[model samples]
Target: MTAMRHYWLATAAKTGAVLADLPGLSVPKVKKVIGRYEPATASFPLVGKGVPVDWERILIEGATVFHLLRDNPNDPAHGIPVWGGMLVRPPRTEADDVQLSLQTAEWYFDGRYVGDKKYTGVGQNLIVKDLVESFAAAGPNGGLPIRVEIVNGGDGKPRDREYQNSDDKTLYSVLQELMGVIDGPEWTIGWEWQANPERITPVLYVGDRIGTAKPAWMPSPAAVFEMPGSVLSFTDDRSYGRGKGANVVMAKSSGQGGARPESTPMVAVDDLRPTFEYRFTPSTSIKDVGTLDEHAQAKLQILKDGSPTLEMVALADRGPLLDVDWFIGDDIGYSIGKSSRSRRQPAAIQVDPEGYAPASPVDGEGYGSMAGLTLDTDNYAEPAPDTRPIVPAYPRGREGVARVIGWELEPQGTPTVTPILYAPE
Candidate 1:
């Protein structure tokens, strides 16, 4: 029997005066809303109209390993050398969420003397040229490089120690020794170096190289993880037990020499879902127009069959508004297909909302809103809107009203799409 799975993913996009009340907030801060389940008397508001909230625990199960090198100095032939060090990743915990961490390390080796008759064990740490080359090779994509520096903490001045040849075998022995010192079960050894303050402190730096190309050691799929399934419904009650408030009217008159025209309430349809209920407090003072009462709540019924559906809800005194806005250019959609014996092939799909006429056809541009494209192997070309090109008739009535412009469905790989809808102006 095929197991039916349900995944709820909801994104709330808000617009209008409700947003105007907030100032200087980041996009994620202002638009994103997290939901929680609690008792009726809980201080936090409820989500979903007429439905009790339910909670599900999410867990992450993945690991990554990093390799690094350090310095060693005990060998007879080579003075100082680079060796591997420890592997590192974020520490997982039950109560806290784990975020990404950046790690880096550097290598330092002891320098040798050329003309001195007596061999002194004390020597300054010097950075080896190969160490730099190794880091560069490992970070071709410009990942944050571990800063490597050589220093001598011994009483001797910097000029007292002679630099060892790059090929010195003694350097290799020193590196091996350093690795042994830091080796352990939980840690993966990379390069190792001496920690004695007198010998020299090797400098190694690591961090998140934001917006930079990733190094080869980094995970292949850039995203940390992919969430599965679709969301059926969502609600937020933070403002007033479901983001409701009293309606207010604003009026103003303009006059230069004569009486000015009176301002009127903006007339527009306020669409609401019947399955959801909203409640708000009334405010006599204009300042309280958008203010919410201390508590809010909502209820919703989960679909039993659970085929997978996406739901989004926003609560506000002014009513819900479509949060869709194009930051880039016009929205478009495409598809890709691959067979066991060949490479993947991509195809564009056409789409059109029910009432609007098909846009002029372009060479490869799809014809519908970004959300209408169906997940299929056949490619569809997007039609240009300006030219008004003739196209196939769209399904009549409300059935053809909305189309999926772009969609993805991959069981083993990452499938993502940006769905956009247009509102009647």
Candidate 2:
């Protein structure tokens, strides 16, 4: 019989976590532990307690750290994990701890946002995919830990219609909020990515609510147990007199220029659940006091959840000239709007405004047809199989991809491809 040597599933350096394995371990031992993920934790293993028995047990207040499993522990950074995310707190834990969990990097996103931004200009779905792929791309432990679906059920209603300003609510906050919204009869989100696919998301029975969803070495339930979903859990001896709950907060964008987001990108939908297969440029305006730059320039064809046409209507610019329906001009045609804005049955009370954010900006670069027509790249591209490959999906420019990959508060983030390769085939 051998004691299983200890190891973490992933790195917490990106975001700090609490170490619960061996509480009595001293400063040196703890430092060895903390060094596992992040570089610094000025405020970590925040301890406070009222433990019973022999001595007051200690509680290390920090995130549960995970990182790629290294072949060499001395320089563990080189190694990576196939799948590692903190549970923060197991299902149905004591009332004291709050669960600040992290899902797998593989993710799926749908829904409109302020310019459909998950970051600055990239769509949320794209960003999440990039992240998962990045882990697969680390120097040593590269490649997806395993193929897992990262699911994001974004809010159907988008409040901030403009990517118009650099100072809008952040994508990090939106993602955090998104997780909070999934009311769970299904608390355990899409299965934690495991190296093994045959393993189903296990059921955590009541009581201790311990261990992981399922640990690999775990004995087959049928052999030693009856209920497939139940298991008594055990935790490190950091036992205390009065137990506290776990409430973890995901990290925000780090401002250290080195740590700041390299770029901002995310997508926005003027309408919920993209209605049209084709998407145009957002309203990227440049009026000095204007909001066109803030506008994703994609156009506004959507309405609120259940508003009367008059309650909240998508109208054309009230400017002197008429707003252009690029969708129709290109022969893409309208979806059935009585007016240029709304396809919903229009009413006398509803008013469609005038003027438009020209598909071509007030500026001249948009009209540069020689070095090339930079205008509306989203809707157009050249034929492929030659110097350039054919791209059929809607395009999101470099800025948009950068926007999506940008992480807050961490400058160590890597840069992305310019003019992103459409859907990395």
Candidate 3:
């Protein structure tokens, strides 16, 4: 059965009361939605051309919220809420259509700053929660319809940390600066929908990782994507650009009178190659000593491996079909058949359980055939030298366990998803 896309225009309040269940005619003209976990954000375009004239008022910037859900044909009322956020910009009217832009809930923190805020010693999550709460509890004009929640205490990291920044900096920027410190926590503004009670809550999750560590909730078998079947195509990128990609990062921050303070450099030799070092500098807004260390540690975590990223075009929807449903931060395994050519034909098939989904044959020899192929063949028949390309190494061993950093879904026809992946620590 094919899935349906649903859009809702609701009041931008904590209750999130639905103001309108948009009809097909009033829905956005475009169906593409993109979501990211880090710097948690989403983007989609909405047009007023086809929308009902009366609904135009609700499209007013900063007045209403937007939600996109993928509904199963069997249960339309209760659907998988994919992306929910506020309008990022004002409407743009061209010819006859008014174009509107929407972003995820995290955009609320984009302009919010932690001006003149000083802290001697405080937990990072607590500091973040306190800042977010100030916005949540603000006047109606300045408040956001969200609540902060810590899923994991950053793997029980120290709480007595210092953060004192006088320069005007967005709350999101502060979080980024702090999280960039090695071993710091990551946060996201995600949606939670309860069918029976009919409640949708915007939750801010901060911790070691999104769904891992203490108070764990999201748990399932690791998602698997293989070529010749699920994966349509993929690109593996490995970079060693100076400063951009490095195994060693020296955290630096500005001191009084523009003086720069330096911290112990953090190193993680992920690449077997010679040491690649880069000096990490936090924004001038960050003035604390400990915060500088955090930024360096975090920068090292990403630069440590030369910032390896994988982009895969998957031939599947993100629904529950074939148990392929996945969230933003889920650990997934994707393997390209071309990369496993050097391994014995059967060993490659065993590596991916779905079957022998070979990308191409070597010397007109197909790996899918089981006829006259046996374990003994690998032992006795291999007197000839194998010239196949060796399988390239992935982040987590040969199976290539990776985290889903972000994804884009095109649900209009022949639903497809393009997933952005990165190596996880």
Candidate 4:
């Protein structure tokens, strides 16, 4: 059934004055809502150096996977804080409510590497090629290559020793630990076709390869408010609960670069839970020096460029602006039937497993599209040299459909239309 309801599942600094009406932000009574039961998710990562706020719980309660975007739309001396993530169409709920359980568009693989299961040699960054390979085994469209744009994101560095993880983690969660040094201090990651496996043309914001925009099938939003109720519903699924934050944790290197090459895997650190201590390094000399708060590291990753600090995390940009496409473009017909999808129109009938009991037209979407054949199939299918087009006339009515009543054709001659009838819809 077509969904008549919508919502945005988002999170923010609970103490912030900006996103006051938060948690379950309601979708305006606008017509341009996303089609189907799709989940919309937003998040604020808790990163960088500072006093730790218990944000690990937030990571679990919110979107399962997220893209850490550095947005300063209003690039002022003080930067605006913005973090973006991914969402998919949720399955039908048992009740009338919607579920916003968001999984990252990127998938992860877990296995034994060096030590126990926790020290699963898997690092923050999994090869895109390998990821698509493993994911394709699940389904047909699942293997399709989705263009994942990792703009301005820092490389995931492997530390000097073997590490252990309580659980596997997503690459996004891993890179969110370090601030961007390549495109720094801000950039955005936008992707499509996660729900619909069809490939979406990529957009080039600045490069010479900039092409025209793609036709967006989903309804665009009108306005985005910072009021509450954005995160309207939550799932009680404990599997993806606090313990299900990131899938893989990066294990330490078996040996250092030179002199102190260890014979066995070096145990760098222990498992990270809702709260874990860390020691980050650009180089040994530039290490965090003391124990670091995992939450604080996330807060710093999202802090404005030069304004990256723990205190600023509380006042960071609290939104995605939540606006839809600026304007809807005209429809450009796409191929169906014989050309695209490599399938032909069926000559057989289709029946719904559930008996056809259509709701009122007001409720809409009561039937699937139907196709029919003419009585004189040869004239329409493979017209003879003298075949001509014909139009049947009947009493004018507000609504009616023409149906074949009979056909006229000799055993050796071309078929022709004989009688036609019109009936009200």
Candidate 5:
């Protein structure tokens, strides 16, 4: 595969008209991030020492939208518009040099709210769809050309839960609170350009599970990365700090007449561990015992089985392609030094593909070197020793599946991605 050229394009936030191509003055200091819990964001420099006059005129805060597209190596005229978002605020500068920040359509939720609404034993997905559609019906200021998709049990049927938003909290916060419910759906604002209409469409995808878990020629599902190969360096910290252990948890919610209702403490005991208790008091808006108990149980579980964190810097263009091979909620398998059964969730990803290229010509080819190897001892040349390394022979440290929660792209000397991982129970 050939390297793809990446560039930014600007357009009108409301009308979506093609405006101008924005290539920064310098090497284009760019950074983009996608999170499971928050809206996606990006930042790039615009005016500097040698910015073109036309580029300078396109810096309208909150009105202009920018897209990061990767051009087809064979057809430069056509490009794949992968990630895009709106300019959330005014450009920042020191001494006349300017930089702009961006946030995806999801950011619009921060301004819209689900005022005076309450749902009792409602499907989580149904609530999400209803809230989003309500905003879209509000016209230009709040309306967006988004298609709502609910899959994997997010259709307001089965898996019922309770939700109440009387204080008029923003849609963003409401969704965050709803999705944080145990076993609730995952979500993302995915984008794609349509040919017939010549426009970019945002897909508000919500589901019980939102990614692929296919066999990747490894002993596990999802893409696998081994040290001394795709993996570069990693850090493992099992210290249960900050989110300390709490075997006993008490949860409380708001009650009638300015009073707060509380739940009996949820306890988990082990003969070998000491007791650590804490109280969890959520927002006053939450006023149901069922909800409070759920929160309490979830907290107690976390405290009982502390989550360890694992992070690593690996080649971005290796193992799997973003969106295609792995998505925001997909599980990724990685081995550091020895293969031990473990699982981690990707809470964040930072990609800095600036000053570096693939270390070897054999990388980024959609498949690893181990993809085609097979056992054919019969065709043997006792002498026909397998040309590939034994699949189990590669050095593997801690090995387990991890869910991708977020991703980032920024400037670094080498093209790499650092994914923040959290051990999941």
Candidate 6:
């Protein structure tokens, strides 16, 4: 049979399999000699001493163009038995080549539409649709082989060059035709228009792990409004002494303040307030397949068992503010606190004079009213002369002051360490 005939037969067989919800017979397996058949070695062993056998779950769901036919037992042809098989072709890759084939097919058919309008026609819409669908079906990491070749136009080589030069024009015409029949915005087509070649690389996949790729196909919002809910607010309030007949009055102001009266006793005040909140929709429908890290290979093992699951958390920032929320959780509020320099106390020392005697010749002793110490006035002055003159000063005792600058609390049983800053002295 001719190649065309064989192709049609294969297409029909595939269609029949789809309609019957059955797996196509494995041609490779059937071609092998039954007695000589040997199972391939497993790259990794499943159990100690045996090779692992892998089986793919047959996909019985797809578009089918044919239905099963029942044969009459009384007919001689029916009694002889009828067998059917489908011809399976490898997937197509190479966007440019696939696009060229589609264009050539349209030109050869004289504008006859073969596939879905949303898929085929102008702008290589059909070709792109096919490529996307194939890519998706093959898994994110799978690659498709696409081909592009120059085709002869009846006008000759020069005509082919013209076609190449005006490829966008041909695409535009096809888009117009498709748009006339379909409902949507006009399809846009261009090359290297806004794409960054360095980052335009395709997503890689090894087994089930899909490599990183920017989702450029996603649609952008018509207009992005800054939502009020996205903003986080914080307030600080402190009051000292009772309201009625209180001798002390405390007033706190932020930003700008008015002049104070001369008779009014005043005290400096400082306060700090900071706010943080996450603003994200809560839903499981949105899946965020995180970037592949060092554990990508190990994670693939889980996907082979079943469909991979994922959760996405939306995050946004405006100026100094940030908002984040989980897509699959109830609305909740969270708080974060910050320290201010003015709120912290300065370093101080506590001294005592309980052992000092006024009549003693000791000179470093002094007596005065202080928070924690009294100085002895009788011995406040330096000694006139010491029986043993002080030995040559050894590097004039270096004076230093050490104070607590910061502190942090690590949650009980946690390995993490956190720092708490202190106001500078």
Worst 10 residues of 2 by lDDT: 398-407
The alpha-carbon RMSD values of the candidates against the true structure, listed in the order shown, are: 27.0, 25.5, 8.5, 27.8, 11.1, 32.2
Of 2 and 3, the candidate ranking higher by lDDT: 3
Best by TM-score: 5
Number of colliding residue pairs in model 3: 6
Give the TM-scores of the predictions, in the order they appear.
Answer: 0.16, 0.20, 0.72, 0.23, 0.73, 0.13
User: Considering TM-score, which of the candidate structures 3 and 6 is the better prediction for this target?
Assistant: 3
Off by over 4 Å in 5: 25-57, 72-78, 92-96, 118-121, 136-140, 154-166, 213-218, 255-258, 338-396, 411-413
lDDT of 3 at 48: 42
Candidate 5 C-alpha lDDT tens digits along 9-56: 776666566677666622233332332322333444553643546654
In model 3, residue pairs whose N, Cα or C atoms come closer than 3 Å (at least 3 residues apart or on different chains), thus clashing, are 180-298, 181-294, 181-295, 181-298, 182-297, 182-298
TM-score leaderboard ranking: 5, 3, 4, 2, 1, 6
Q: Measured by TM-score, how close is model 1 to the native structure?
A: 0.16
lDDT of 1 by residue, 148-228 (tens): 433222222121212233424233232322221111001111222233321212233211110122244642212111111
What lDDT score is found at residue 196 in candidate 4?
36
CA lDDT of each candidate? 0.21, 0.22, 0.55, 0.23, 0.58, 0.20
lDDT: which candidate is best? 5
